[model samples]
Target: MSPWVADIEAAVDSVLQAYHRPGLPGVSVGVLAQGEVRLRKGYGLADIAGRRPNAPDVPMRIASLSKQFLVTVVLMLEAEGALSIDDDVHRYLPDLPDYGTPVTLRDLMSNQSGVRDFLELRLLCGGNFSDPATADESYALVKSASRLNFRPGTAFAYSNSGFMLLTLIVERLEGRSLESVLQSRLLSPLGMTQTHLARSDIPWLAQRAVPYVVENGCAARGEWSIPLDGAGGMISSIDDLLKWARYVADPASPHAAHFRRMARARPYADGTDSPYGLGFTVMPYRGLDSFGHHGQLPGVFAEIAWFPQIDAALVLLANTTEINPFHLGRRLADALFPAALAPRFPPEVVPPGHYYDPGENRVLRVLRQPDGENYLDSAMTRAPVEWHQAGRFRPYWPMLHLQLAAQDDALVGHDGPRAVAYRRLPTGYAGAPERFTGTFYLPGLESLWRISLHDGQLTLALTGRFGTRHFHLTPLTDEVLIATPAQAPDGHYRPTLRITGAHGQRRLMITTDRTSRLVAGEMLPSTDR
Candidate 1:
């Protein structure tokens, strides 16, 4: 190992050590500088039961990182004059309903198309990822969507449907498989021998790591699957990722101008700049402009980040769902270029103390870390405070703001212009919980999520694409109910529910924003079971 790489190696080792435990799935990391692999290493057990060790060269599912390849192909086709990003999607998929306005390819590429995420859409339709649904089936499911979450170009929403459509478009234009197009256009050109778009034909990939999930300190296979299409597809090794990320960082290379655009931010009709462009997220890490993509799927985790200013790229791939490699890349960057990163941190930070917001019934706990750093705790989540300016802190949730001044007796919490006061008080809520009893049917899901009023206790019994689950609702308001799960194995993350529709029709809707958007359903007879 060279002296230049030792620091990065140590930094990566620290991250690996944090995640590496006995019977845990493993990780692989690759660092690239100037088109060469500077460092590559793997840790933990790739297959704990099989006694196989993970290596940096092993390809794992890259998930959403595959979107970059779709974006690249689209840009390539555009450069070839075959199509334009501004072309309406309906032009390609003519049967696609034109909902008031045109949805352009650019909107899809930049995630301003407002397409409901395909995975979320599947669950919304009571479809399971583990089910063997073809790409055409997936397309039909997306096509059947009655309305987009929002109009294209007006808002930015992360979507998998847009990319799936793009992959289909790519295959349609080239009249060949997606794998073939990717190979001839990008992978072969970059000498990325270990990378491939996830394909069923190549089931037994060489040096491939078996995906695993950890539960109770033991490795186990997870019951999760995603279509190996444009959205959450592609299996790649760190070496291949390094080559690809390095390629993306170079604006003077193939599809150079488009590559530059991929790293830049575009705005919506509202003029709010979107942090995402093409397939990569454009953000500041330690005050340095960075372009990267984070991918997570059941039993698979990966992060690919390119620091264009430093002319370096970092790739982290893992076989487990538990680890997050996103910040490890930043750590490596900081370690390699300490002098470049030191100025980003504040010289001094505030001490641990309590800040209160009694109106909303929450207290802000500023707690000290083991390292003496202070963090903001809001009962539910603890987060490191990012100082946007002196005495001002941005809340992890965009809706809230915390500002403190050393001058006066109390630190004030502000919600916009209003001076919202905080106090320490025990809060409780009781509402009309029994009103929500009877079978509600979602046509999209084709299943009834029956809420039964069993002896004054409210319970929800529902069937998913894969299995059945139960929940008990805690009433928050007359129209709001919190559905807490009884038992687990469900990867679903629905937390809240709201009941409405008194005026026109008695309808049931999910008021809480979940990953999946289930259409409001009509109430069916109790005998409909």
Candidate 2:
């Protein structure tokens, strides 16, 4: 064993030890260097009441981490010339309504299809993830409510519905169940015997690491029964994940050629580049290239990050819903390799303007701080950013780098790939105040919004997870307005809100990038007396 192994082990232990509270669910972690397993361990409990101790070989749901397999199957079809990534998805699955432009296979795979996420859409529609549906049922739901957030390939919005379409495509092309294809093509060849894609019609495994959700104190078993075979459903162990991570970095693997092809960093139509590829996110963190994916559902959270440049991989599979594998994966990397961990974003020089990205029908504004700094504003979050050369920018704090649209002068780019595209707005725009004073509700989200006109300005309040958040609305145009969260006094959360109405009926739509891409939602008048 290397002498540095002790330091790495201790660092990882410090982080996991904190999660090892008595009666709470725990996690399984694996560390591999140069495609070799250096450390594999379990912390806390896999089943608290049954008293079954967690281990590296215990199987747990991998959630969206399963997307790579679906991506692989689709790429195989592409390789065989049966289908091309650029082909119109209507060629394979015509059930999906055409929202003007045809969404291509590449668009679906890369999250630029403008398709709304199936899971969140369900939630927005007064449904939860607990109820499982058949693949056909899931497809019909998205197609029935068929609408694209934006035109295909214009902006980036992660959509599970897009993957679900890919799932149908793969099955139709291969003429076999996705399970059989996954087993024969990727898993079997790689010798990953433990991993399997779970389906709705037939259950695969029996006993595995039990999943949990916290109650008042003790952890209790929880379930997320959403139809997830293509988008999120996956079951594997740490041992299996260790091999999968090694495979993720191995260019010699069966799908290495396809892997490299899919991993190519995507530059959006707006000239902004992001870390997301076909199914993987290829990012530069502290001077190293990290290839990884994170998956989450109720009662499960899984994440695996492979630094191909360093030949290092970090994985975390937790049965508990509260454990955020993405955050933990980053921390694990920091602990194992402490070199070059310092952050160097949110630069000192700030750009100030309202960038209008009509491609996605959104606005991104950066305002000057009294402290001489600049911050990005939105309804969701308010974070500081710094200007970089050649139309690029780096967010100092959140580890985001952006490539702006092709511009003559301004340093412009998305903080990361698939971010909003911004064109510097021209000078001189008018104001409209009385048009928006009303109560609106987004039925799908089960959330409410109130806009009021006071003293020729608009004040908006939204009931969110963090209670009601308030923002002062400034009109960019008669139809569009900018609302920066008052909580972020420094100006990081700038959400562009657009209102459309006719005959006393109105709709308010939000097009900001965050955990989920929100679009084309109704804003109904409040009946509250």
Model 1: how far residue 469 lies from native, Å: 5.0
RMSD of each: 5.8, 7.5
Model 1: per-residue Cα lDDT over 1-529, one tens digit each: 3224446678667657766666677788887877778789888777777777778777778888888888988998998999999999988988775566888898988887866666655654445556566666667667766566667765555777888889888989999989899999998989999887874424666467877777767777754545568776788888788777777776677677887888887676766566678887775666667777878776777888877766777888888866545645566666676555435435245545544442333345566689875666543234555554456554332212344433243445453323555432223455566677766766654556778887778988776453456777766555555565666423434444556766224566552221224445656464475
The lDDT of each candidate is 0.66, 0.69
Task: State the lDDT at 273 in candidate 1.
Answer: 62
* Model 2 residue 374 CA deviation in Å: 15
For candidate 1, the lDDT comes to 0.66
Query: Under the 3 Å rule for N, CA and C atoms, how many clashes does model 1 have?
Result: 3
Give residue 174's error in model 2 in angstroms.
1.3
- Report how far off residue 90 is in candidate 1 (Å): 0.8
Quote model 1's TM-score: 0.81
Using all chains and alpha carbons, the TM-scores for the candidates as numbered come to 0.81, 0.73
